[model samples]
Structure formats: structure tokens, C-alpha cells
Target: MNKLWGFIVAYFLRWFPHGLEPGLRRIGNPGPESPVLVSGNFSLTLKRLIRSLVGQDLWLLVANSRGINVWCAAVGGMFTHHNVIAAIKTSGLADQVRHREVILPQLCAAGMDVKAIREEAGFQVRFGPVRAEDLPAYLAQGKKKTDAMSRFRFDLRHRLDMLLSNNTMFYLIVAIPLAIFWPHRLLAFTLLFWAAAFYLYLLFPYLPGKTGWSRSLYSALAVVLAIPAADFFRAGQPFLHYGWMIAVVLVFSTVGFDAAGILAAMPSDAEAFLHRLGIKRLGSLLQEKTLGRVALDREKCRGDMICYSICPVGVFGELDPDKKITLPWQNACFACGACVKQCPHDALSLQPRP
Candidate 1:
């Protein structure tokens, strides 16, 4: 029953921080030579990691990322070099581990300063595979990550998971009041919202837009159009009520706007477009300036292809194997800093558009 409840409330749990007890945890029976893995203190993330390492002998260092998962926490700036260093020191890891190396989730690379952590914490940080499930293989393979393991995927199952995480709370909040006051309208809107969300998630790749904002606007417009068309079937009655249309439009637009974060991959241009729209609605103005773009230092680039594989968008292209790489679609760069951090040779940097 406890497991069932945890599964049911998983979506609600993602919104806030959980499992904030930051310290060192001994997983299984570990000697001083056992591997030490570090991760965020998000309860679910910790739980998942624990389950994955059920039989493995190791030490787990839980860092306070304000209860956020490693990826999101790092991107939001909550997970940083300070958090990792604090965890290392406060947990007294030095006394327990014989080696001076710690493994962090690869996704955390974007937010964490690896060099700073090593310099301050006195431990070399190695990034593990992107998924916790692959930890055993990664460890067994001498801590080497393959291109497939490093790549981030947004397949159908992942999209469904994202849809639930993003929309479950909104549905519950809106459904309760309507269910209490107007059960009929509650059912109608519930179905509407569910359908709209499914459309957004399932058809996201095919959505006719370059940016998240544009795709969301297009999807919202479809929902708005469907309402009037459905009403039209009721002949001899008003096909479209102005007030109802306005309410539907507002709800759809509000939900769609969330695509800025919920969408599997968002480009930098889309983020800028959403920011402009958000600021303008408050009766303010934004003087547009060219934002920074990712720049490659050819001399420093080892042509390791890590950047090409890890980039969410296909920003970097290979000109020659292990020799040359070119930025064909530099404009699509989201500046997530994943490539910059993962690059072994310090070949990549973000430079402001001049």
C-alpha cells in the first residue's frame, strides 16, 4: 500500500522538493574501496537510486538540491558546486572512502562546476550514465559512458511520463471545484483538458513550429476551434457563446504556455520569444538584443563528438570523424551548457552575439 500511494502521488511530488536530509548514506555493505555515488536529495530520485543499487555495495552521498531531481535542479541553479562540496564535507565522506573520486549523475554537469568541486572538495568528480538503470554496466565498464548511454531520448513512454507530471496537478485543482458545484461541466472540461494535453504531448514532434511558443499557440488554437465546432452540432442553438469562447481560449493559452518547460526539448529562440510575450502582457516593453550563441574553439576541440551526441538539438555537426566539427545550426542552441561541461578539452564556449 505504501508503494501504491507513492506511485499515485508521484506527479504531485515532482512539483516541490522532498527528502531534504543531506548526508552520506551507506548502501549495502561497503568497504573503504567501494564506489561512492552522489545525487540530489529529491525523495523519489533517491528512492529510485536506492532501488537500482539494491544489491550493489557502495556509498551514496545525498546533496541538498532543494528536493529537485538532478537535471531540473541543476538547470534551475539550485544544484551547484557548493552543494556537492558541502555534501562531501558535511557527510564526512573523506573518512569513509579510501579513494578521492566521486561519481555524479551526468545530467548534473550542466549546473555543477566540476573543476571547482575537485579543487575545493578534494575529490575528482566523474559523471556516470544518464540513467540510473545503467549504473551497473557503467561501473563494470570502468566508468566509461558510451554514446548511446550519454544521449537523451524523448520517446513515447517519456512523453507520457512528462504529460502526467506536468498536467496532473492542474487537472486535480480544476476538477475538484467543478465536480463539487457542477458535475456535468466538470466532466466536459476534464475530457477537454485531457485531450488537449494528449495532443500536445503525443504530436509534439510533428507540431508545425520551430519554437515551443509557436507550437503551443498552434495547439491552443486547435482546441479553441474545436469548441465552437462541437457546439455547432447542436442545431437551432447558439453555436458559439462569446463568454464560453473567451474562457476556453484563456484556459488553453495558459496551459499551452507551459510548453516552455514541459516540452521535451526547447530551443533558445523559443525561450526568448516566451519571455518577450510574458513581459509585454504586464504593460512593459522589452528591447530585444541578440542573445549569446555557442562557440567552438577549433584548437581546443578534440573532435571527441561528445557535444554532437549530448546536445538536445542537433546544433553541432561532424565535418570529419575525430578531426573536425562544425556548428551548422548554431541558432538552435539552447545554451544548456551540457556540451560545455561535458567537453573534455574545453573546446566549447558560449559567446554573446556580436
Candidate 2:
């Protein structure tokens, strides 16, 4: 793939599902004993993962995900165990590898049926680190994914990347209407969006509220109040800046509201809110949670720490000396069910809110 072209498409046009061919790809040189991995056919995910897999001898089974990323595809029912089974059966990976172990991305835990995959494909599924970059270190450390690897970080760089990707289409579509009607404000509109987006994403962590929607309201309030402040600074002159205030409020509201969807931790908050407003078809896609609080069964506990190891929000506390688990961060769970799904002993569960 042309690296530049791949980068452009992945960032700019990701809203559209685009893909590379699905099949088995070899990284470095692989033998029959090499480790096996799985990924979706999304071009960007493929590009990033290939970089992480370089200089390693392994088999990457690219499953068909309708050109979407693994996490989205899995939850959407496109990259189920059936996809893995088909890839394994058709790609001749079983014949090529002696081991039946496949390191699937951990984010797909909500959608993948580990037992079903093993039963159908004869491959034991081991969910890998949440991010592709951790793969190299996870492999180096004898295929162990550290707790740090499972946690998600919306750092400045990644947040900026998300800002660019999420807003590219929004701007592209909005730019035309602005240019046609409000030609003079077009530059101002573009600048305002960039400014609001950068402020919201860059300062996301420091912003108040557990959910992105909540955090956005504060930002929108600030923007709404800024127009009066500007007037105050202009020696009490009436600037009639209400239009710009309205613009800023809308921009901040739009950016902040979207923060929930783009952000890993708050992915469900906005969607759930929208769902409550009766957009069931769209909101239920990823945000609606039928399950409630996550609970652990003490009698069945093996303390394998699978739940602790796989949680993106660090809800499951550290393992106890007696090999039991704790839920010190219970409120953080978005009900994605990664822990419940990956728990080996069936000890973890989701309890309805009381």
C-alpha cells in the first residue's frame, strides 16, 4: 500500500468503509510454529498493525469486517466467530500453523464468542492488548498483556488525530453551505471549529464531568458567555456579537457532544442520551446498555484476573492476595461487558441497577 495514500484515506475518509483484500498475510518470515493473529480488513487498522508486526514471524488472518475497524465490526456483528472460522478454514492457516492460538484484539471482546470460535474454528482465542502498538511488547514479554496495555489513553496526539478524523467530513460538508451562503464568515467558521475542536479534545481530560456530553455543556456555556465578556472588554460598547456567540455555542456544543462518541471512555454516554430521546435505531447501535453493574461471584472466583486484564476503564481493581477481585472503580463501567465475556470461571456478572 502507498503509505501516504493509506494515511490520507484512513484519516480523511474513515466514515466510508474501505478495505484491503482479506486473507492471510505474512510478517517477516513465518514457520509452522509461528504465532497467529487476527484483524479486520479495514485499511487503516491494517496499516497500523502491519507496522507493529514488522520484523516478526507470524501469520495475520485478516477477517472480513465490511471494511470497518475490528472493534466496530465485531460489535456490529460483522466480525463474529463466523468470520474467524471462515478465515481459518479458507486461508489454509490451520495447515500452515501448528498452534491453535489466535491473538484477537481485546476490544472485540464484547462481540466475539470465545467458546464458539474455539469450537467452530479449533483455535483458542487469546485477546491481545487493546492497542496495536502494544503487540510488540506483549509478544516480547512472552505473550502477556500487561494491565497498562489494556487501559485506554486519549492522549494529546491521539486526541488530535481523532479531532482531525472526526471533523474532516463535518468540515467538508459544512464548508460548501458556508461558502455558498455565508461566504464572508466561511473563514471564521472554519477557524472557530478548529479552535473549539482543539480546545475540547486537547483539554478533554481536565474538563469536568464523567461523560463527554456533560463536559461539553460547560464548554458551550463558556462560549456563550464569552461574547458578553468580549463586549465588556471593548469598553462597554454594544458589539451585537450575539451571532458569533451563537456560532461559538453551536460549535462547542457540537464538538463536545461528539466527544462522547469519539472518546473511548465516554463512547456510550452521548448515544445513551440520544437513545433516551427516542433515536433507538441509531443510539442503540453502540451506546444502549441492557446490562447494569458488573458483579463478581466469590464462590466461582478463580482470580485468573482476566477481567482485570481486559478492562479498558480499569473498573476491576487489582487482584487480592487471596486471588479474589474487587470493583473499586465500579462506576466507570460503560457496560461493554469485556470483563464478563472474557472471565474464564464465569465468576463475573452484570447486576441490574437497584
Worst ten in a row by lDDT for model 1: 280-289
For model 1, state the Cα shift of residue 323 in Å.
Answer: 3.5
Assess every candidate by TM-score.
0.82, 0.90
Clashing pairs in 1: none
Please give the distance, in angstroms, between residue 2's alpha carbon in candidate 2 and its true position after superposition.
Answer: 10
- For each of the candidates, give the backbone clash count: 0, 0
The residue-by-residue lDDT of candidate 1 on 1-354, one tens digit each, is 965655555545355445547899998898899999999887776888889888889999999987678776676567888999999989899999789999988878777777888899999988787778889888889888876677566677777877876667677888899999988898778877887788778888788887666777777777567666777776534445656666566555545655644555554443466456654221011112223678999888877787876665568887665586889978866567878877879888888655
Best by lDDT: 2
Q: Which prediction has the highest TM-score against the true structure?
A: 2
User: Candidate 2: lDDT of 138?
Assistant: 90
What is every candidate's alpha-carbon RMSD to the true fold?
4.8, 2.7
